[model samples]
Structures are given as structure tokens and as C-alpha cells.
Target chain A: MSSKKLFLIGLLVSFLVAGFFSFYSSSQPDGLQKATAEQGLDLTVVDSANADSSLANYGVAGIENERLSGFLGGAIGVAVVGIAGTGIYFWVRTPKSGETK
Target chain B: MHMPDGLINAQVSIGAAVIAAGAITVGLKKSKGTLDSQTAPLAGLVAVFIFAFQMMNFPVAAGTSGHLMGGALASILVGPYVAILVMTVVVSLQALVFADGGLSALGLNLLNMGIVSIVVSTILFAGLMKLLPKTRISIIGVSATVAFISVLASAGAFVFEYSLGGNATYNIASVLISVMSVHVLIGIGEAIITGLTIGAILATRADLVYGARKFLPAHNLLIKESVVA
Candidate 1:
């Protein structure tokens, strides 16, 4: 298949996974959090600097609907990373000189 | 794992930041090869996919959960250098925009989840691909195994970093043992997700997979040999 179709499929997968399947994700704390608790190192963890952001913890702050909040947050993440990553890569990318348009 | 602020002392955090900065600078140069017009969108989509997948946590052991670190998959799909850049973007976005990881601990987060994992998987995948038989099944097996071990390697790096400068005191050996135990389970999940992703990509567009590029020709050679025999 063409690279274009593959790219679109991958991006669509990202949106679906982030927007929908993410709601079913396990809410239990991740490995570091679990290990921190077990090792008593949880005390050292300070609140993230951006913790007050409306999208902190993947939930839109003050948004009553949990799934919608997570979906929006995840979608926003996809857009942010997609734009930032593509722009940086395309900027730094050396153009293959005069091969094609 | 996303290290939180104050979880690591300033000594290690800043030290890691310096290393990460140097690595990312070098990565920017090397990533040029991996990001021509054809693959540029692929790289971006991979980052978006990682960000999306990182949210889906799977139960590992007891109450602990693990999410897709994406280093193994990224480095295999893109080269390690570009994978580092992709991971840097992902982690930075998560910390800055989402507040998933603490700002102060960004360096360590980037190091463990991005650099170390990529390095380990690159080496392991390169080595295993050379040693294993040339077939799609064997290639996928090696990918899964290396992906699993890279998780442990990255986790071990965290344990080492913590021993050097963690604020809370604990027995180093004990810490290592417990961390490894839980993470091994997580590593299994990582392996499965990585293998499945790669398998799908291979079935659809093996040409786009950097790590499997070497193996594809090898597989063709094996088929040729069997046909001759």
C-alpha cells in the first residue's frame, strides 16, 4: 500500500486508542508509583509543575464527565505531539537534493 | 516510568539533564536520514501513536500497572536516533502540556524511557537479528524478546539512578530485587504489545520498518533456497 494510506491508518489508530480505549485503561497506579509506595519513596514525589493545568492527570480539570475529559485530553495530546514532532523532524530533515518535488 | 519532581535529588536530575541534552543534540543530526518526505509523516504518526498507547495501562502484578514505553517499537520502526527525538517530543509534551510527569524530573524521564531503552533495544535487536534464523516468525520472536529485555534494562537504570541519589533510604539489593520483579511482568506486557504492533506493520508495509528491513531480504533468500531445494 501507499505510505499515505498507512500514515492515515496509524493516525486514526492513535485517535481511537486515545479517545475511546483509554477510558478502559487500568486506573491502578503505574509501576513507578507502585514501587515508590512499596519502597517508601513516595514521599519524595512533588506535584508536577503543570499539575494545575486543566488537563492534568489526563482528565480535564472541572469537567464532570470523566470519559469526555480523558478523550479530549488524549486527543489534545495526539495533536500536540503530532504537530511538534512532525515540525521538528521536517525542519531538521535534510532535503534529498533535487530528487523530486 | 515518568519520574516525578523531588523523587530524585537535584544532583542526579541535573546530571541526567546534561546527558539528555547532549544526546538529543546528536540525535537531531542523525535523525536526518530517517525523516525524508516519505517517512516524515510516519515518524509523526508513531509519536502520536505512542502518546495514545502510553495511556492504556495493563495490569501486570497485583495492583501495579504498566503502559507502553514505546522505545522498542519506535526504534524498530524508526532508527534509534530518530526514535530518541520522537520520545523526547512525547515526554516533553506529556510533562509540559499534560503534567503527566514533573518538570524537574523530565531529564530522568527522558533518559530512562527514551535514551536508555532505545540504546538497549538497538543493540539487542541488532545482535539478535544477526544470530537468529532468517524468517518472519523468528524476526518477530527476536523483536518481542528484545523489547521485553529492554524494559528490564531501562528499569534497572532507574534503580541504579535511585541508589546513587534517591532521597529515601533503602537497601540497594532489596530495591533492585523488588523493582525487577514487578517490572519483569510489565516487560511481558510490553513485549506483547510491541510484537503485535510490529506484526501488523509487517503484514501491511514491511518496507517502512527500519529494523525489519535487513530481515526481509534474508527471508526472501531463505525462500529462494527452499524453492531451489
Candidate 2:
């Protein structure tokens, strides 16, 4: 497949998957958190100084809808990672001025 | 595992970041020296495939879900040097773009998942392949087993890191056991997916597979013999 076609397909698939993940992600504790909770150590864990940041909780400020917050978070994630990743690949993979292709 | 911001201490995070940066620098130089025009595009495609597979999270015990790390898959399909570079790209993207992992903790995440898993898994897998028969099935089995073990090792690295910088006072043993056990099961799932994917690719385009070199001679011999007949 052409690079453009491949990229578009990847982007589309990423959007759908990210949407699904954002929608269906478990509210329950993950492994570390779960283990901490079970061991009664969760109480001692302190949030980072930046915990007050809007993105800290994967939600935008004043977003009352939890589902929307998650969707937005997931969408932003896809865009950010996808663009950044592609850019890095291009930058690193690009041949130098003197280098032959 | 994308450890969000504030999960690990800043010192640990920064330390890991330095290490991750070093690895990437080395990887970039190594890849530039060795990466052919042919292999570069394939590496990109493999990254996209990994990104796709990562989206498919299988059910872990109870309600938790786990996704493929693709460290072993990348390392096996590509060389270790390039594999680490590919994985670093994936992880860096995940952290910076999606905020899946914390920005500050990007270094640590790369160390844990990208470097440790890809580097260690590739080395172990290559070692095993030397001892085992170079058959397709054997390669798949070795890949799966190494992938599984590498995941467990990753979990151990997490536990060790946490012990040093952990905010919680949970028993180290319990945490280790829980994380290790869950990851082992998760690793099995990772193994199966990676094996099947690799097998499928090999069946179609064996030359595209970087790790299928040993089998290539035999396959070529068979093809030549058939053509002669």
C-alpha cells in the first residue's frame, strides 16, 4: 500500500480504537492501584504536585460528563501520539546532508 | 504499562529519562548505520501494526484488560537495535500525544517497557533460537516463551523501581507477586498473539521477516528443488 494510504488507514483505525478504549475503560483500579488498595497502602500514596492539572485526571476542567471527558482525552491522546510519533520517525529516519539514501 | 504522572517519584522518573534518552541516541546511530532503504519502511509498517495490535486489549482476570506490549514482536520481526528505536517511538508518542503515560515519567516508561523488554527479550530469544532447531514452529515457540518471560521481567523491574520510590507501604513481596502473576497470564496472551502474527507473516512473505533468516535457506532450497522438478 502507498504510504499515504497506510497512514490514513492507521489513523482511522487508531481513532476508532481510541474511542472504544476511552468509552469502555474500566473505572476499577489497575493492577498497581488494586494491589495497593488491597494491601491498605493506597492511603499513603500521595498525588504529585501537578495532580491539580486538568489533564492529570484525563479530564478537562468543568467537564461534568465523565464519558465526554474520557472521549476527549482519548481523542487528544491519539492525535498527540500519532503526530508526534510520525514526526519523530521522519526526523530520525531522514538522511543527513552528506548521507546517501 | 503507561505509568501516569505522579505514579513514580520525580527523581526516579528523571533518572529513567536520561537512560532512555541514551538508549535512543545509541539506537538512532545504530539504525542509521545498519538500516537499509528496504528495512526502514518495513520498520515503520511494523510500528503501525504494533500500534494497531496494542489497541486490541484482551480480558485479563476478572475485569482488568491487558494489551500487547509488542516489545518481543518488534525485536523478533526487526533487529534489536531497530526494535528498540521503534518501541521508543511508540512509547514516546503514547506519552506525549495521548498523555497515556505521564510526560515526566516518559523516561521510566521507556526503560521499563521499551528498553528492558525489547532489549532483554531479543537477546534471550536469539540465544534460545541458537539452541533450538531453526524450524518455523520452533521459532514461534521460542518467540512466545521469550515474550512471556520478558513481560514478567518487566513487571519485576517495575516492582524494583517502585520499592525505591514507592509512596505506598505495601508489602514488597505481595506487590511483586501480584504484578508478576498478573503479567505472567498477560504475557501468555501476548505470546500467542505475537506468535500467530509472526507465523502468518512468515507464511506469506518470509523474506520480510527479519528473524526468519535461519529458515530462509531451507525454504529457498525447497523452492529451487521444486523449480528443477
lDDT of 2 by residue, B1-229 (tens): 6676666677887888899899888877776645433344556656656665565566677756677888888888777778877788777766544455667778888998889998788789878988988888888888889888878877788888888887655678887887787787779888898888778666665555678765565656346635665
Which docking category, incorrect, acceptable, medium or high, applies to candidate 2? acceptable
Question: What tens-digit string does per-residue lDDT give for candidate 1 at A7-101?
Answer: 88899999999988999999898988888788888887789878898888877888899989988888888888889877765754557793233
Worst lDDT run of 10 residues, candidate 1 chain A, spans A92-101
User: lDDT (0-100) at residue B16 of candidate 1?
Assistant: 91
Docking class of 1: medium
lDDT of 1 by residue, B12-59 (tens): 999999989989988887776545566667777888999999999998
CA lDDT scores, all candidates in order:
0.85, 0.69
Candidate 1: stretches off by over 4 Å: A92-101, B218-229
For model 1 chain B, the run of ten residues with the poorest summed lDDT: B217-226
Clashing residue pairs in candidate 1, if any?
none
Q: Assess every candidate by TM-score.
A: 0.93, 0.77
